[model samples]
Target: MRSVIDIVDLSTEELDDLIKVARDIIANPDKYAHVCDRKKLATLFFEPSTRTRLSFEAAMYELGGHVISVPDAGSSSASKGESVSDTARVVSCYADIIAMRHPKEGAAFVAASKATVPVINAGDGGHCHPTQTLADLLTIELEKNRLGNLTVGFCGDLKFGRTVHSLINALSRYEGNKFVLISPEELKLPSYVKKDAIKSKGIPYEQTTNLEEAMPKLDILYMTRVQRERFFNEEDYLRLKDSYILTPEKLRKAKPDLAILHPLPRVNEISVAVDDDPRACYFKQVENGKYMRMALILKLLKEAGTL
Candidate 1:
């Protein structure tokens, strides 16, 4: 609990404890309101990450702690030739804990290597986004009332959807779970995800390009935008872009109890027609993110012996 660099590092007991604390925070915010009154959280964003940054700030604010942030690398000493490690060392002097998001893969590992204060990785390129994974887990448990034995469908951008990757890896350890990866051929789930997280374990899985065809069978549908910025050519982006959009018409084929999830700031990958469906859980997911962060902040501060 010293640093929340990865969800993979947390055991089942630890994960359960965190979820419990998060629930307690949601039910009784006043009990822990001043726990972090004298603390500070530093946000070091070496890249543009609006949602994650704001979520962390909101969580700390709810705990009555203060926050100091650098919006991006260009606005800070990072633009003046200061190394990330060097910047982290300086910020540690002023903050109780650090949360960083960087464009480079494994950048958080580099920061934690140098930071004296506990460091949480908001994201590190496409390598991982562990805190978001925590949020997703919290949302899933709230929406479904449980975690295991579900058929989860991952649709779109599986090729570069780090959230999808982290979620699959985390959920793979639970019992009676299966996966359906729906994406264009060019955007199929990565080999490591298939081999390391799915295929080798004999976890029942199927892959297809048709979202409509996949809908009928899923307990949870996790949608990700097609990530146009990751495209190399216009033809490729044009070909695969709309292959994943979720609309109400298409969703009619899905089970009534099916819960739809998304790592948002979504574009047209999800149609407005589907927003009114009781199954659409993205907005609720956003609120759940705050509760999860509240739990996380409490755990970290407690572990640091500050709360």
Candidate 2:
């Protein structure tokens, strides 16, 4: 079986296939329902989450499968100092597949190395969130009708936005796509990500501090909260917390068809007023997340001979 530990682990063709499956499911839900009948999905979340965790659980339910969850590390064997690998090995005995979220970087990778069944990385610290990228791709495809030849702007906490990192890696493989990285200097996209996902790919990209300047040219405007959880210094987080807020007045300069996305739990970075705007696709992004996850679970289980 295969494990989805990073976006880079999936090729563009594979992503396209998943998106196609998600689209088909969206089009005819009844036909696709019960594809994973009688299967069990184990959600091993070592950290607290809402959207990602719930989306995975909802996806399994829609497929007529059962969910077995370790909602938090405090309630799991990990509280007794059980290792991730051991937990993965043990859980594989009870479930057909595993979707995991952890606060430590590479924790999913460690689990995937030991798990007998497919291990899907729900999220892993500031490192990566591959499944979120799947949702993002499906959203973009549904909205824009294509993945390539668009300018996308990423604003706010690029330094530790694992969703931003994963999405950029996935999109860079497509043709004619450019990136505008917008954030305060302290929260700029990490240098390693720039080197590996952007520069090494020879994809054109610009770095800027002005969100307004970038908005007018973007087909997609991706906003992220300056994650307080990733910062060691509370003072630093407070200082940069409100660097970029998307107000309606600010969005007036944006393209009428701009797709606004946020991997959310927005803490004042995006005004609630912006939700009424047709351009706001974050909520739509949430629904797409469930369908994409359903697509992933179906693929993994079928490959594992469990479906």
Candidate 3:
């Protein structure tokens, strides 16, 4: 069974195929509605996330499947200290596929390695969030017309943003793709992401602390929340927090077609004033996530021969 642990798990052709499916789902939803009829999707979320959990549940339901949710760890076997592997094996017996979210790094990997059915990593700590990357990719294609040959700026919290790292991994293979990482020194994109994903692939990228300077040059400015908890010192958080906020004044300096996106439940990183702007694509990105995931459910079930 195919399991999504990381973005690198998908080959170039497969990525193209998945994107095509996602686009097709957006174009013709009614045609694919019955594809997952009567199938089961088991969600094992140790850490509660209302958006991701609800998106998965909605995707399955819209595709005519049933859902089984483990919303909290305390109410499940995990509270008594049952291993994740044991839970995976047991859940695999009942569901055709699984999607998991956990607080610990590599928790989804541990479960996927043990499960009989295909397992999708929803989010595992700050390690990786592949599905969000899928949604971002779909958003990129829709907003910018093409994924390749575009300058995409990932602004704010690059170091801890799993969405950033996963997107870089997936996009590195596309021809002429460029990345502009806009973050403070403290939240720079991690070295493994730089060396392993960007530099190794020979994709051009530049890093800077200035978001406004990078604005007009970008086709996609992907915003992420800069959390106070990421800073060890309160003073450091207070200083850098204001640097990343997307004000209307900043948007005025951007390109006319620039797509400002966020994987949101956004904090103060993005100003409320910018929401009225036509270029704010985060909410559209959320709705698109549901359709992308709807596409995903169909693809997974087809591969499993259950569709």
Q: Highest lDDT: which candidate? A: 2
Model 1 collision count: 0
Model 3, CA-based lDDT: 0.87
Error in Å for residue 171 of model 1: 0.6
lDDT of 1 at 259: 93
* Cα error of candidate 1 at position 39, Å: 0.7
lDDT of 3 at 275: 94
- Point out where model 2 deviates above 4 Å: 227-243
For each candidate, the alpha-carbon lDDT, in order, equals 0.86, 0.90, 0.87
Stretches of model 3 off by over 4 angstroms after superposition: none
RMSD of candidate 1 to the true fold?
A: 1.7
**For every candidate, C-alpha RMSD to the true structure in Å:** 1.7, 1.9, 1.3
Give a tens-digit lDDT track for model 3, residues 32-115. Answer: 777777799998889879888899899888777899876586467998889999999999999998989999999999998999
- Model 2, 90-190: lDDT tens digits are 99999999999988999999999999999999988878898889988988999999999999999998997889998998899999999999997778898
How many pairs of residues collide in each model? 0, 0, 0
- Model 1: runs farther than 4 Å from truth? 71-73, 229-239
